[model samples]
Target: MNEQQRTILAIASRVMSYPSESSAEEREHIDEAVDENIESADIRKHLRAALAPLDALSTRDIQEIYVSTFDLKSKTGMYLTAHEFGDSPKRGAAMIKLQKIINEAGFERTEGELTDYIPMLFEFMAVSPEDAHHERLQRRLANVGQRMLNHLEEENPYYPFFTLVMTKVFPNPTDEEVARLERDREEADLEELPYPIMYQ
Candidate 1:
């Protein structure tokens, strides 16, 4: 998998591993028990390791996560309520408290950008239209995949690799030009390719 994919997996794994809440036995649970935690900083170490190869993706990464995850899916109001809280005064207060805790742990809080919001959109849809969500997301992925393939072709000067793959799958194409090139695959492979796009 790509670096971003690995980072996403690492974060997902960390969240899955962390306990959301814990309860204690009766009596004397108060008075200065556990020290403030560096959980976020610890987790950030893993996240940074996984995402290091994707340094170019820093600015756009969070936005992609938000978009893919937060789709409005439920009528029960839970997800929407949480999403709304971020924009409300109560949430602001909560965020301050949360940030303090994280800061004490030597970790910084970061707001996701526009692309990150897309994941939230997906999550929203999943909660609402259970069956349709899978299909919709599938189509979206395919479209994006195709675009990536096209991008690879456009950015490369060694002849279009995508076109080569495509026309090969359809040998009886109306364009004999494609057939002719297929015969000269070695020649095409010898051409110089350009550098890939730098995300930054």
Candidate 2:
């Protein structure tokens, strides 16, 4: 990825993470990154739009919106594997695989956050070297990111941020692939149980 792409991915990762009182500093950095790195006026416009509320709203207000948008709604959760596997053992396996990839790339996991969290993955991709493993992982994340985008309302402030990030990771996904991901996401949502039973 180029400098602009890398800069935006890093910015998106932080902006999409849970909001904190200290986020004003982050917003300043985001503005600077846009001004310095982002060349496209359209993308700059959308990114600034996505972040405008952060500048206006208190941290608690942003936190409440964050919790409602991603935490309360399982379909819109940042944990990407949950969209594909729900609460299944398959989700656990996928997370383990993702953790291994993060370890191999030497990207440290955020405390109290799963490796498959969208922000965690974005942070990893921003700094990690591009390789076969990276490409494969990007494809997997692209699938989940697209589904999350489909779930989100276009008017949601974060929607443009996600669109920008996914655009960089999966620049030109085919129509057939998009259809396939939507179909699979629907099937997974239907077939996977919300709470699995376990026995010893």
- Write one digit per residue (lDDT tens) for candidate 2, span 33-62: 889988888878877776675667788887
Give each prediction's root-mean-square deviation over alpha carbons.
Answer: 20.9, 4.0
Total clashes in model 2, counting residue pairs 3 or more apart in sequence or in different chains: 0
Worst 10 residues of 1 by lDDT: 26-35
Q: What root-mean-square deviation over C-alphas does model 2 reach?
A: 4.0
Backbone clash count for every predicted candidate, in the order shown: 32, 0
Candidate 2, run of 10 with poorest lDDT = 186-195
Would you give me the overall lDDT of model 1? 0.30
- Residue 68 of model 1 has an lDDT of 29
Clashing pairs in 2: none
